[model samples]
Target: MTMEANELRVSESVPVDTGQRRGTRPMAPDDVAAVGRLFNRIFRRHDQASDDDLGRYLQTVFFGSPHYSPELGSVVHENGANGIDSAILSVPMAFMVNGRPTMARLLCAFMADGKAGAVGAARLARTMRAARQDMCFSDNASPVSADHWVAGGGIVLPIQSLEWQRSFLPLTAAAILAGRHFPIARSRVLVGVLRPIDRALRRLRPSMRPKTEGECRSEAARVEEFLQCASAMLERFAIRPAWSPAEFDWLVRVASMNRNLGTLQCRKVVLPDGRTIGAFLYFGKQDAAATVLNLVFEEGRERDVAAAMFAQLDAEGYAVAVGMAQPFLMNAISRQRWLSFRHRGYFCMVTRHADLKEAAERNDIYIGGLASETWSRLLTDF
Candidate 1:
């Protein structure tokens, strides 16, 4: 079902009929291939992405589950001769107000319909009503899609700023050398290092040390915990693979290439008795020299291990570190002296169905970090 431009034109002027029952349902196991195909079609049309990149994007979406319940997850399909002319996707993420699950951010979303906008809005309305209090919607605000949601009554939400990081430079050395202009040099190197690290680290597990007192005392304990959990779960947990069987190798390939970008460094955590309890991917160090990708601990150990890792880095005579605004984890790093905040600039826009005004009111959430289908797919390349 890789839709051609001519065929997609049929969906261009979607009917505005209020009674149309374009099926919007939870995505099933059988839906992965079709979903991947549709995603590729939309992204290729909009972003000029490559098939390889599109495959990677689909891999992230359909990996390892019979159904994805990202707090906000659904698929919309039209009943046409071709079947399912449009689609929408949502991933659930929680945001806290006073440490409560006050918001649910829609991490991924897509839509294809002109006439059934009302029906789509109604369904999202129902979904939002069922979600937590502070509901947030996020997606790439495409001109066409933005107009559609606006017509359906959804308002745009603003984002604070966009932030990103990579392990292309050791902040300590960078500061000693350049004084201030480190990131400019670091970004270029990250792109260059991706291929080489990708070839290595697949079988290498660096030595890790136990927590020191400083780490035990820091607020980063929470972040350390989560990092540990994510690592353990991703390893040896033996869940069914989420992405297409054919694409796993490609995911691995891309990951290998991007390893030096420091996005997938994970470490296993063992209990005192030597029981392998958890693991985590590490994050937050802009290291050009260490050759370590972003690291993660077991989800639950992020906060704890982070302080320990930082203490270790500082004790080893590292001078400075940069903390990107990566929510809770980075927030923890910002509190430490060896780490300082680096500011980057960009704003975000959120879009959702306009007719779901009541649901928006009830959910009271905002979505951010959403890229257009094009950009989202394109991200797979890097």
Candidate 2:
């Protein structure tokens, strides 16, 4: 069957709520246009995308995925005017828990229109959490959304929510950080003025330089090669994604499409004998901050992997390197004086299974990177 026809059949299977003008229902292919409008109204008000563009994105991310599950599909709230005012985008994922295959729902890009849809939004969130999936979680939640998740019996993971940064050029990094809030700081003239100061500061603090003395070296890797390295690195974790080769390829391809973040770079750290010990992925650009997407290493190889990754970023002229702080890498990050940590958002999860909940609370399970919603273009693209 054609993709559109398959989607329509999936939508028809879901029972519609016709009793009320304002109610939540399973999001269908037909709802993409309205959901796109609602998304722009809430998250992209200043720079709204054309309906056609948004429709294509929604289709690719939600409907086109091989993992899409109708029972755990996205949800939309209908207003009195038969229009959508609230939405919660969900991407179904397969995971391995204690050697058993489990399904999960990764929530992303939630939105509600002003006061009119506030309650509806909350209800929609609750609806998603209450789905039949083994677990539901999000790593890109705002403080408001975090509170809602907590209120709905979800646990807020303190460790997974923190972000770490290592600055190679302090002055330039500061300006780029400030640019997020002030446009003037991002001006070419201001950036040009800071560049020289950053050069002097780097020379003044030789001890702060990222260490590159490890015997391991990073080699550019294809997505499939990274997956092989990742599989070896993540086997120790009790609960982790169990994506098929095709699903993983699709995920990485979608992640690479976020041009706003810069070019996607993937590399595998290997020993002198060519044994792969680690792998890292990130978006990098010259004179700008590089955002790490996933960084995994074998036990006790954190320092080697981290050193190689940062050395490469520094050599590429990135002013700073940042990513979600994984608990296992905390010691390596702390040893570097140039690296710092900051709380960004809450990584919250909801699950009835006690083992899964405890494992997550103790930081035994992996939660960020491919497991989270950071790969979505909706976050970085207009």
Candidate 3:
């Protein structure tokens, strides 16, 4: 789902596999429920949301938003009663490519059975690439999807994953880390000892407390407000996604459907003169872990907004937080001593016309939590 540079040209073509019995076809309006069932069956076990709740959520994910286009999406047919085994949903996104307004596809809902494997995945991946012209990319690729992406001519960008931090509940964070490294650390005594130490550390540093704001305090905000905040924050990079009101509305609405994985949250920082200087959209996890999906602030005043947001989270009982390390938000997050981690998967992309892969590596373009499909679909289950 991409438009030509400097012009809005939507392609009417839908890609179909020429020779395979398990050929690809565009997603039909009626297929919404089946898509929901398939996705729920695949992800519901690990996902925290209830089955009925997730089905409703999936409807909004697949078709409820304005970002969807049947022609730009693809599904694989099988011998099953529904004749469908897998799917890849596409969102037609607007971008600032080479300093011009552009459209691209951020692929979503990519799933296939183990039986489908690379063969089925490769066919579907190719079909998606053919659906767009400007570019086709995904930052939420699973290990299997990453392989399929390369098989279809996409290149994975070498950028590192975001920085993450543990604050109040450092014991739980430490326990989880230790459990991963060695099973012996999973003991009641270890937790009991560390709990006291963590509390002492908090008491020693009064500055660790989140501040209460009179005017610029955190409050509930709409998705539109979140995007308005995003648009106002100019890019540090040369290229970035330039979304329209409609697109932002759709993305934010979809993003708010966090299911039970996390509570969808928006925090706006207003100044004394009644001006909104910054805002952020985040996932407040059920386990008290806050993941900042999108953070927008005025260029020179990023740290101020960030400090206010963190303070608010601290008051709300959030013990830990994580965020993508976009350069704009680094100064704010780094001040808290957030540790960096390797990106889990690839920032896989492919484009016939421009050097999208090169641009991504050179930091000439922007791709982060919100621009990718991770906020709504991928990270929700985690």
Candidate 4:
């Protein structure tokens, strides 16, 4: 039942050193649970997340409608034990430039099963050899086992740009925005925390009477007003395409995922004018002092609407607020109270390649595009 030399076709599409002893075997569907558990132990343990939530997250990323490819993934075990000790998952993405096609492997995740089998040096070497030619990658905030990745010969470098981390507890969005040295060009909209608001609403529900029908109508009108403002902004510049409800739903779901990981919460921002112009997803623990998340606005409305929204959130008492700031969003996040979050908050370990690095840098700007070699192992069985 052993893999024979003839059957083991060394993938030439990518360059990797196969001299290492352990070889990659494609992950099987049955291996998904074990893979999930491994990830849960490494990343979700501290979050105190329920098994159901973790399972749901895994299902969405791995078993949902669009299943990840097991062929591009592998589970590395010292010997042929059915239970996986380590795993690597990857997906191929074609980036077109100047009418030319460039193929890159998006590493999903890599995980080791609590050091049970203890990933061997040979396993790492072989996997790296296998992935080298294909431009294998990993993300900055991945929960992958870093030790194994380094053993596999992957070097951590400033691929694409970098992952920046900001602590909402220590500062306010106003401070970050106001920092003169912060990259105004890169700044975007501010996402404010609604933690206090959500908790207060719940606590005061019994004592506080519900708003009257007229008041309810007026509130609904505000949501519509914001929506109108957002729509108008989109029409003016035509920068970002109009957002569909489906996209908002996806945003909401992603927000929930973040909440499980940390203290962030998300809410759709409704303006007094009766429109839902934008959404702010908060990140931070409720018990913590601040919340930080992204505020996405309809492209052209960044200046007028997003600004007003942040001001409102600030007045409402939610602390630390921050937003993605690229040149387009500079005007919104650049302010006296907003402090600039430091860059290099996250990093990706990738095979050294000039062109691939450039693509990764651009992908860093968007959600779900960061490539990390650790992703390969974590998502193999997905």
The alpha-carbon RMSD values of the candidates against the true structure, listed in the order shown, are: 12.0, 4.3, 5.9, 11.8
- Name the runs in model 4 displaced over 4 angstroms: 1-22, 40-56, 65-67, 72-78, 89-108, 113-137, 141-309, 315-317, 322-345, 349-356, 359-382
Q: Write the per-residue lDDT of candidate 3 for residues 1-382, one digit (tens) a residue.
A: 4523322222222334553234456667666666666666566544232355555655566565565565544454443333556666666676776676656777766766557433545556556553245677777577777776676566666553444564655765566345534746645577657766766777886655655434565667876787777775756555576867876767766776666437777888888776887888788865346777777778687777887788877777665666666655665566764344546556677665555556765666666666776566544442
Candidate 4: count the clashes: 67
- The lDDT leader among the candidates is 2
Cα error, residue 259 of model 3, in Å, equals: 4.0
- Per-candidate TM equals 0.41, 0.90, 0.74, 0.49
lDDT of 2 by residue, 219-300 (tens): 9997677778778788888888887897887888777777777888789999999999999888886678898988888999
Candidate 4 has its poorest 10 consecutive residues by lDDT at 211-220
Judge candidate 1 at residue 126 and give its lDDT.
36
Candidate 4's TM-score reads: 0.49
Candidate 3 deviant stretches above 4 angstroms: 1-22, 32-54, 78-82, 116-118, 128-133, 147-153, 158-160, 173-197, 205-223, 235-237, 270-276, 285-287, 338-342, 377-382
Q: In TM-score terms, which candidate is top?
A: 2
What tens digits encode model 1's per-residue C-alpha lDDT throughout 97-139?
2223222334355644446445543454333332222333444
Candidate 3 Cα deviation (angstroms), residue 321? 1.3
- Cα error, residue 8 of model 4, in Å, equals 11
Q: How many clashes (backbone N, Cα, C below 3 Å) per candidate?
A: 66, 0, 2, 67
Q: Rank order by TM-score, top first?
A: 2, 3, 4, 1
